[model samples]
Target: MDDIDQQLLLLLTRDGRASAADLARELSVSRGTVQNRIDKLKREGVIEKFTVELGRGEREHQISAFALIRGNADDDRRILASLRRIKEITQVSTISGTFDLVVELRCSSLARLDEVLDSVRSLPDVADTQSHIRLRTWRS
Candidate 1:
């Protein structure tokens, strides 16, 4: 991507719902140019998808944590599928470290978080799990 494409992505990253006209104004290009660039970005897979960051009011009530997990290698696939079924577990990533996976959790309450943790631990494939409750989030 060129400088304009890079700049266009930054604008979209800041606000996914930004209009073509607004993006064009920000990038000092025509609306058609902005639309075409967005299309290209999507086609080339530079921008996979757009998502939302829960607002402060809702986020304040959200219990977020990262669970570092160790599990049997043979059960990795099943474990991931199970984790995906639990709504509170938003992200599950396999990483190279002492832990086999890192799971991100966002729950409605402490009780809910506890329940989710227990459910994760009970999975036969899950050998062990260490959780760290998030105290604050300065950046995404």
Candidate 2:
């Protein structure tokens, strides 16, 4: 990706719904060029997927937390599969050090979060887990 491509990604990250014409205008490039670059980015896997960033009001009603999971390396695949089945688990990543995996969960209520946590704890391979609820967040 070149400078223009990088700039396009920044703009898209701020607003994924930006139109080709809008991006062209901001980047001072032709609409076709913007479209071509976006297509190339997608083909190259630089653009994995477009997603929505919830507004403050919407986020205010949701609870976010992180789960530090410890498990046997041999059961990584099974553990990941179980996590994938839980709709509240928005993100999961294998990590180093004390924790084998980190999971991000967002739920509408504390009760829902508790239920999700229970489900995660029930996984046979999950030996232990430490959870932290996010009290506040700041984003750029």
Candidate 3:
């Protein structure tokens, strides 16, 4: 990416909701140019998704946990699917290294977290899992 592309990305990363026209003005480029650059970014998968940063109060007050899961390929999909069904599980990624899957869950309370964990641990494919409760969150 060139300087202009980098600039556009930086601006958009800070405020995904910014209008193309606004970006154009800020970047000293045409609206169409801004739009094209954004389109290119999206096509390249550089721009993941437009998201709103929700405050703790705005969202369910919950503890966040990351888990390293182990399971067979088919079991991995099933486990992830089941985890996704839980409203509290906001992020799940199939990763490399010692862990097979990395999961992030947001629970409303300690009881809710235990409930989620119980559900996950009970899965037949899950051999073992490690979890860490988030003490603080800096950003989305």
Candidate 4:
């Protein structure tokens, strides 16, 4: 990771789909040089994968919330597995500090959130849960 590599990474991070010729022009290098550097970056795992950012508003997206879930250590796997099976649950994390599990969910309405909470409350392992709705997101 030299200065050139760092610059290339910065450019690629902004747009992974950048063409070799475009990158070469931006970096003031030949196409072949850009290709080789990109190859090296990929080989070294500097760029793991590429993904697209979806427009949530136009999609079947719903209200999203973050939940702090407290549960017993023994039920960690089951609780996480259950969360994974739920389509609305997009992200789940075993967190430190106050929360055992941090869960992110997308729901159509408050009623849907209530339903989801009911299921979570029914889980014997879940001792408590605190949820907060997200008002807006400037960036993903």
Cα-based TM-score, every candidate? 0.90, 0.92, 0.76, 0.70
Candidate 3 lDDT score at position 33: 96
lDDT of 4 by residue, 4-90 (tens): 789888888878888989989998989999889888988998888777755666434677888899987655988887777778887
Instruction: Give the C-alpha lDDT of model 4.
Output: 0.82
Better of 3 and 4 by lDDT: 3
lDDT of 3 by residue, 7-46 (tens): 9988988888999999999999999999999999899998
What pairs collide in candidate 2? Answer: none
Regions of candidate 1 where Cα sits further than 4 Å from its true position: none
- Residue 109 CA error for candidate 2 (Å)? 0.7
Ranking by TM-score: 2, 1, 3, 4
Worst 10 residues of 2 by lDDT: 72-81
Per lDDT, the best of the predicted structures is 2
Which is better, 2 or 3, measured by TM-score? Answer: 2
For model 2, give the RMSD to the true fold.
1.3
What does the lDDT read for residue 139 in candidate 1? 53
Model 4 compared with the native: what TM-score? 0.70
RMSD in order of candidates: 1.7, 1.3, 2.9, 3.2
lDDT of each: 0.92, 0.95, 0.85, 0.82
